[model samples]
Target: MDNQRRGFPKRCQCGEPVVLKTSTTAKNPGRLFHGCPFGRDGNWYHTFKWTDTSMVEEIEDLIEKVENIDGAAMTLQKGVNACESQIDTLAMETRVHLGVVEKEVEEMKMQLRSLKNIVGFVMVMVLFFMCMY
Candidate 1:
């Protein structure tokens, strides 16, 4: 018999379909079983069955698998967050290094301009001396 059929009783003593309810206790957390709704009023004309131990065990196993998957997802999220943080830090460092390089390039351009002016001045002086000679 299937776990669902075994776990769920077909009919109550009152000729109604048994309602499924989950056990909330520590020993049977999330365990699915059938109960007679009419039995809630302390009537003795109700049926009960907890012999579907395989179904409860299967449910517990599935719950554990889900919890493991959730844990893995959390771990993966943390790794992604760490990678993002590292990327941001590296980007900031790269920006700072680029700024320094840009400043150095500008200074080199200024020095080259000064050197060109000095060379032009020396050439003019040489030409003037040659013209006199």
Candidate 2:
């Protein structure tokens, strides 16, 4: 990976550009090394020791760290999305509750008006009885 990122080395003795390939065997999983592109034709130029194991480990470690950071960022984004959805749901609930409260208030106002009319009629009846007496 590093070699690909930095660019391939100069041509081998076979006059073909070396290719960087990762080892996939259980013994050397994820190990990066270089090889001659024409090695299958018996040119056989290889450099397994060009990069030290420690260097390969360092690069692998950096790659793992980057992957972890990306995973964490995705998790945080999902949490933010969930919070926003909850906020929207609560806002809707609050609007519905406000509507119900407003209706109750209007009903109370109508009841109060009816009570006031009843009280005024009682007062007038009392005044008429007093005049008669």
Candidate 3:
């Protein structure tokens, strides 16, 4: 039986349509099989595959497909986790940079205030010198 074979048997190797029939013997009673009517005619070469075997092969194939899908999903989840980690790192870097920029802006404001004071004193001295003259 081929594990890759999917679904039930539709036709036998003898080019005859398969039929589902139950066994009625002491060795294996009430067992189901998919076989051709010609297969039961006391022929040496006949198709007599068990329905249970085909079902088992089909189930095996479905299990393999499910396992492959699960593996792909795990890979995608790992990629998503990596992207989230990178985003967190960038966010932290941006916060640190913003803090540095704000401090620089405050320092510039203080320097401007000092320059204004110096200019006001220079203007007063010029006025006093002119009054003395």
The numbered model that scores best in lDDT is: 3
Clashing pairs in 3: none
Off by over 4 Å in 3: 1-5, 9-50, 119-133
Candidate 2 stretches with Cα past 4 Å from truth are 1-55
lDDT of 2 by residue, 1-133 (tens): 5644333355566666777767677987887766666554244454333345536666777898899999999999999999999999999999999999999999999999999999999999999999999
- C-alpha lDDT (0 to 100) for residue 95 of candidate 2: 100
lDDT for 74 (candidate 1): 100
Cα lDDT tens digits, model 3, 1-133, are: 4433355778777888889989887887999988788886467476776789778877888899999999999999999999999999999999999999999999999999999999999999999999999
For residue 79, what is the lDDT in candidate 1?
A: 100
Candidate 1: C-alpha RMSD to true structure equals 9.0
Best by TM-score: 3
Q: Which ten residues in a row have the lowest lDDT in candidate 1?
A: 1-10
lDDT of 3 at 94: 99
What is the TM-score of each predicted model, taking all chains together? 0.56, 0.55, 0.58
Per-residue lDDT tens digits of candidate 1, residues 1-133?
A: 5545444467887898777777777998887657777765356578555546646666776898899999999999999999999999999999999999999999999999999999999999999999999
Model 2: how far residue 6 lies from native, Å: 20
Q: Is candidate 2 or candidate 3 better by TM-score?
A: 3
User: Considering summed lDDT, which 10 consecutive residues are worst modelled in model 2?
Assistant: 41-50
Which model is ahead, 1 or 2, in terms of lDDT? 1
